[model samples]
Target: MIPIALAPASPPERSAWRRHRFLLLRRSSQLAVLALFLLGPWAGLWWVKGNLASSLSFGVLPLTDPFVLAQSLAAQHWAEATALIGAALVLAFYGLLVGRAYCGWVCPVNAVTDAAGWLRRRFKLNAGSAPPRGLRYALLAAVLLAAAITGLPVWESVNPVTLTQRALIFGGSVAWAAVVAVFLFDLAVAPRGWCGHVCPMGAAYSLIGSKPLLRVSAAHRSRCNDCGDCYAVCPEPQILVAPLKGKAGSGPLIQARECSACGRCVDVCSTEVFQFTHRFDHRRD
Candidate 1:
């Protein structure tokens, strides 16, 4: 067995790292808000003005642009098909290496919610709890089915990034305004509300997250005091907390399909209760 060691550091060093992590989270939240409120809308407007396909041009990630791939796949054009497949493989590889860090650190909607929740705390509004984990899968199925049948990328309509971009560029249409309002309310009132309960991309990640490779682990359970700080701070609390509390089964490392592996739990845990591990090790736990 590979031996594990504590992250070599004094308490002061560890504390400094914690502060840095929190700062990163806060800065990420700020950038997300800016992107959603400013750049996203501009991109959307450009797409609309040019009559360009949103996915093909204005999507959050270039790899996620479904229109080109969908068209290629639908047409069964070998050259386009090969290119699309290659791109997909690259994205999958990148995701495995990062472990959904994008969802926690970079997703615009998630940032909006984080900012909203920060504001709501002053009003004593509690962060809303996540809905049933199964809901995401159902939503994913519905979205894919609709996209397949209608040949319209339905994800664009509800996507927070796209909505934000549209709102920024169009100067607030009714639809864009609603999207912004919902995002603000959900972020402020609910932790990862958009991602935890609604994001179809999250559903896709959850399905494949449990591969035997590229997992996180809790290296020193004995250090745990059960203070629950990690649980309290976890953005994807349902996934991280319930399992550690022994209230849920361990299959998917985190139960919520929405977990973005942002390392918030690791940052908050006073006991150093968690770390990245392989799936084989995660199952053994």
Candidate 2:
């Protein structure tokens, strides 16, 4: 077991940029996407309009949240052709990449939860028991069920991801409070409670991108020092067990649907035990 004291440390031999390259790239991706949304409202640039729920890019490209589309369909709300196109685009994008990549690279709430995680490690705070991982799938089902029964897309009203994006681009509301609540919950109550165990949208994405080309491989598992830094930083550490420990006939590819493909494992491993690769790359050392 990696002591909590050593959990946050990355491979020190690598240059600082090498150690944190993927992390920095993810942050840049998240912030850059957010800035595009903010440009129209804050600076009147009008590059991307609407919110993450649905948006028009350059008034030509359409992008919609497929989960929201599902909810709308469940509610018997007829969607426009553009909405359909948008949803298809999103589905196709995530179909090629890992689904929860949205959580790691695009969701604004990710920034909030990530900050909470960093603080937890910095303070060595013990995370209490988290809710079952299966709970999110139930919540996903319930969200659709509520949409069907109540004739409303109920989750959207309270979804932290959309709320955070809306609040950041459009000024202020309960988004800050909602985002803060998620941060606090992850920090004090559960280590990775929200995105890892409770977000319905994440559940929806996991299903959509259940099989993706992109994956993190434990190709060099033989070099692992058992320092636990990869487990310490992974958003879905449970997926690492089989690949990292290397059971007979088990491939090095992390094939789990829940993996966010966040690359924190790759970033923190002292021995370069993990790397981003296609799902087919199972070569083990």
Return the top candidate by TM-score: 2
Give the Cα error of residue 73 in candidate 1, in Å. 6.0
Q: Estimate the TM-score for candidate 1.
A: 0.65
Clashing pairs in 2: none
lDDT of 1 by residue, 1-285 (tens): 999987745333366666357548656664754554444445644321221122223433323333333433344443344346545753575345545555565555555666665565456567567566668778767776676677665665666566665555565676577667766657554555666666666665656453425554554554667777666556566566544644444442453435566676677676566765554554423
Model 1 RMSD in Å is: 8.0
Tell me the whole-model lDDT of each prediction, alpha carbons only: 0.55, 0.89
Expressed as tens digits, the lDDT of each residue in 155-260 for candidate 2 is 9999998888877766575877888889899999999899999999999999999998898899999888899998888888899999989777678999999988
Compared with the true structure, the alpha-carbon lDDT of candidate 2 equals: 0.89
Number of clashes in every candidate structure?
13, 0
Every candidate's CA RMSD: 8.0, 5.2
Let me know the TM-score candidate 2 reaches against the reference structure.
0.94
Global Cα lDDT for candidate 1: 0.55
Model 2: how far residue 86 lies from native, Å: 0.8
